[model samples]
Target: MQLTPTLLAEATRRGLLSTEQGQALWDFLAEQEREQQHDTPSFKAAHILYYLGGLIAIGAMTLFMTIGWEQFGGTGLLLISLVYGTAALLLTEYLFERKHLALPAGLTAVLAVVMVPLAVYGAQHAIGLWSDGDARHTAYRDFHYYIDWRWLVMEFATLAAGAVALWRYRLPFLVLPVAVTLWYMSMDLTPLLLGGDNLGFFSDLGKLISLWFGVAMTLLAFWVDLRSRHTKDFAFWLYIFGVLTFWGALSSMDSGSEWGKLAYCAINLLMIAIGAALSRRVFAVFGGLGIAGYLGHLSYTVFKDSLMFPLALTAIGLAVVAIGIYWQRHEAAIGRSLRRILPAPMRELVEQRRG
Candidate 1:
């Protein structure tokens, strides 16, 4: 469905548009796409450096915090965070206004939002609201690795700050922090929801929550993609975290029965199908890994002594590859046939893209 130079030239020849008009339209759109490519963070060297340097600075401020950093009184830490956040915000303003760099501006703004959790932590510590018993002695890195209900305050504050930054900037890069905060919240909220009463129960419940939150995030990503067709990818972060949480939670489940394992495999395959439909490779990746894990388990446990199992699996893989080639060759015809087989309303749904 994409309009390319060839399509435009063909259209001009077919009298859909005058030659001049066709060329003009193509040129305009080509320029726009080029500009967007330059501005948006991607695999380009400049963009990579922008994000790498920004992440390094951000990591220094948060993730790489030393025990010595905690020696600074809570008030001092809070003041320092405030100073850093203010500087980041000022840079964001300068970039947006003078430099016209949306991606860099959003990254700068995320730096500010990134400081929120630390600032909130300091403020909480300054008051008598330090984290749970053992968490009080835990390093800042533990905030990421471990879930404590006390961390909810920091997560909420970070999410709010990220929301404000995104609202003010309208930049896609800002979604990273928000998506991350949501992921953290998804884990942290588990303890509170379950009242942190039983360790084993909490672990299982947290995984369930992670799976559902991922599902919700994935659905939301689809909604965003549908609404923002032909624009920069605003749903990329959502898709990433969604797939991570969903696949992580699903993979962690200890399926006892063969039926349970088969169901798990089926869900992963469904994820692959969904990925193909949506053109989101994250879904395919997670699904592929999940299926691989399942297959490995079967190989090591159920079929350890069965040489035929590996042969059968190899044959299945070859069949899939052959099917893929056939699909590639006649995708349009196959799609038409599938749609024709559907009810009228369903056919319309299949034929239509987001718009």
Candidate 2:
């Protein structure tokens, strides 16, 4: 299916295409390839470096922040965060407009979005929003490691700033920070929704809320996936975080009965079917993990003493492998058939490229 220069030359020699027509076709195809390379993420060394550098910079300001940063105090921290955010924005504009570097520009924009929470935290600290003895008052690092209702203000600010950055840049990478902040919000909102800090995150109410939130986030990602038409995928990060949130919460919940566990396996199988229909590997990955966990449970508990257990498992494994090979061989036909079962409007959505 790949068109090459040799193929074009052969066509020209065979009189299938005139020399001028072949040259024009080659030029158009080459330009399209160039654009695709520029806009899409790949494992190319330069692209890897771009993401690596950006992630390190973002982690430095957020995940890897130190307690030493607290020495600056409220007003000083606020000023420093403002300065850093402004500089990142200026760099984003320069890279995007003057240098024509989309990847680097998007990274800088993400950096700016990441700074919003820090800035919000600083502003809150300056205004004495944190009481003197509170743990959250002492370090910004708790934003990631701990769950508290107090972090809601910063999370909301980050979401708003991320929206602005996405609007300004129209870059797919801008969705990364936004998706992450939404995940954080899902956790933090639990304490507030349950009406007290007395119940920690592991409480039953918190888990149920997280499960519901994950469903909402996944539906949002689906809507975005259907609408996106850009060269780069904008819903990829959203789908990843959404599925992780949902699956993690669902898996962590206690399923006491045999029937309940069987239902879990069935749900995971449905997830696999959905993944095939949507062409999203994220669903397939989590669904496969869920199914594997169920199998492991059966191995250790239900069939542990049975003599035929090992043989049965081996047969199932081989069957799965054979099915995978068959699936790969007829993947295009299977995908087409799956698409046909969807509604007309949703069929179009299914045809869109997935991350």
Best by TM-score: 2
Residue-by-residue lDDT tens digits, candidate 2, 1-355: 6899999999999999999999999999999999789867889998999999999999999999998898888788889889999999999999999998999899999998998888888888898886557754457888988888889889999999999988888898999999999999988888788888765557888778778878898899888877784345788889899999888889988998988889999989988988877888999999999999998899899988889988988998899899999999998888778778888667876776533
User: What would the TM-scores of all predictions be?
Assistant: 0.87, 0.92
Q: lDDT per prediction?
A: 0.82, 0.87
The numbered model that scores best in lDDT is 2
| Candidate 1 lDDT by residue in tens digits, 1-355 | 7998899999999999999999899989999889878786679988998999889988888778776877776787799899999999999999999999887888899899999988988888777576345534455556876776768878888988888887788888888988988888888788788876343223877788888999999888877776555556788899999889888888887888989999999999999988776667898998898899889989998899998998999999999999999999999888777667766543443345423
Supply candidate 1's per-residue lDDT for 131.
Answer: 39
Q: Give, for candidate 1, the lowest lDDT window spanning 10 residues.
A: 346-355
- Checking candidate 2 for backbone clashes, the offending pairs are none
* Candidate 1: regions farther than 4 A off: 1-23, 131-135, 197-202, 336-355
Deviating ranges (above 4 Å) for candidate 2: 9-21, 135-138, 325-333, 352-355
Lowest lDDT block of 10, candidate 2? 130-139
